[model samples]
Target: MKIGIISDIHGNSEAINSVLKNIKEVDEFICLGDIVGYGADPNYCIEKIKDIKCRCIGGNHDFAVAGKVNINYFNYAARSAILWTSLPLKKENLNFLSNLKRRIELEDNVFAVHGSPQDPLLEYILDKDTASFIFSKFNFKICFVGHSHLAGCFSFSENNNQVNYMNFSNGGCIEINTNKRYIINCGSVGQPRDGNPKASYGIYDLKNKAVNIYRVSYPINLTKSKIINAGLPRSLADRLSYGR
Candidate 1:
């Protein structure tokens, strides 16, 4: 079976549509949250996820918009976007965000979380120390996460007692090693932040025991226009071009 992995889709319909269009066929989709936050089409994005029945977790932005997280915790631009996104959401869509779990365990010893396993919606496992520590917190052979919006992989080898990081910002593939545990970030489908403006996603081929990261271009100007038209923070729209 093949699973399409997506994360940090901050309400950019253009990005999500482009990603969905570009990824190869899969048996399922697993979203790492932030379905609505920084962009303009929160409802549309949520609806698309719902339509595909993607198994998703709640992101910090999603929690903030759902009133689960303190709005004050976010920075100015993110706070403004969250407040603006909350106003027009339908009742059911709000419920969807409100009810998302912090983590989900899938078949084949795979785990999914919005951030790190220790603090699913808050902590970031970006560096070596954190990745090493996080490796001790989960028992899954493969953990998929996305909160930092950077696409990458961190692997811990039991035999060598070593941890290695590989940047997948430009896209790459890896053959799963049975002796190593992995923490994979699928990157941001909407608001990529690894200095790449293109939308990013990942594919996990269970049968083949391999993972592929990919990046695709989308209609950025269109999403930017929507963000500006919605009266959201201009920086939110501007950041899409730089992916930072």
Candidate 2:
């Protein structure tokens, strides 16, 4: 099965729409969350995801927007977006955000989470040590996570019991090793922080055992203008162009 994985789409409907247009012909879509925070058009983004029939998990931002969690935990820009999102989501959209799970186990033995497996709404497994620790806790051959908005993959091989980080620039297909395990971050659909600034997402083919990360261009200025027009914080709009 080919699954299109997306996460951290913080309400830039333009970027999300652009990414969706490129990823044609996938069996299923899996969203790792943050559908409503840090940008404009929270309701529109959530509606788009639902239209695409994506299997989603609630992100920290999603929880905050739903009033299930406190917004004090977020930063100034994120908190602003959260406050904005809380006002606009309708009853059905709010329930959709509320009903999302923190994690999902795909049929192909891959586990998906908005954040780390250890702490779904909090911890980020960035380094090898943290990745190794999380790998030890889960027996799945592959675990996909997103929160930091950086696209990368870490593989732990049982042969040497070592963890290795794969480079995105290589552009090679990653074969899931049955004896080993992997933690893959598909990056953000609306905001990317890995310095490239383009919208990042990936397609995973379980049958071919290959994963390909793709970056697509979007109208940053258009999204920025939307953020400013929505009365969201200007800093949030500024960051999208720089990808910081």
Per-candidate TM-score against the hidden true structure: 0.98, 0.96
What does candidate 1's lDDT look like per residue over 147-189, in tens digits? 9999999999999879999999999998899899999998999
lDDT comparing candidate 1 with the true structure:
0.93
**What residue runs in model 2 are displaced by over 4 Å at the alpha carbon?**
169-172
Q: For residues 137-179, what per-residue lDDT tens digits would candidate 2 score against the true structure?
A: 8777888898988888999999999999975532346777777
Candidate 2 weakest ten by summed lDDT: 167-176
Q: What is the number of backbone collisions in each predicted candidate, taken in the order shown? A: 0, 0
Those runs of model 1 whose alpha carbons end farther than 4 Å from true positions after fitting are none
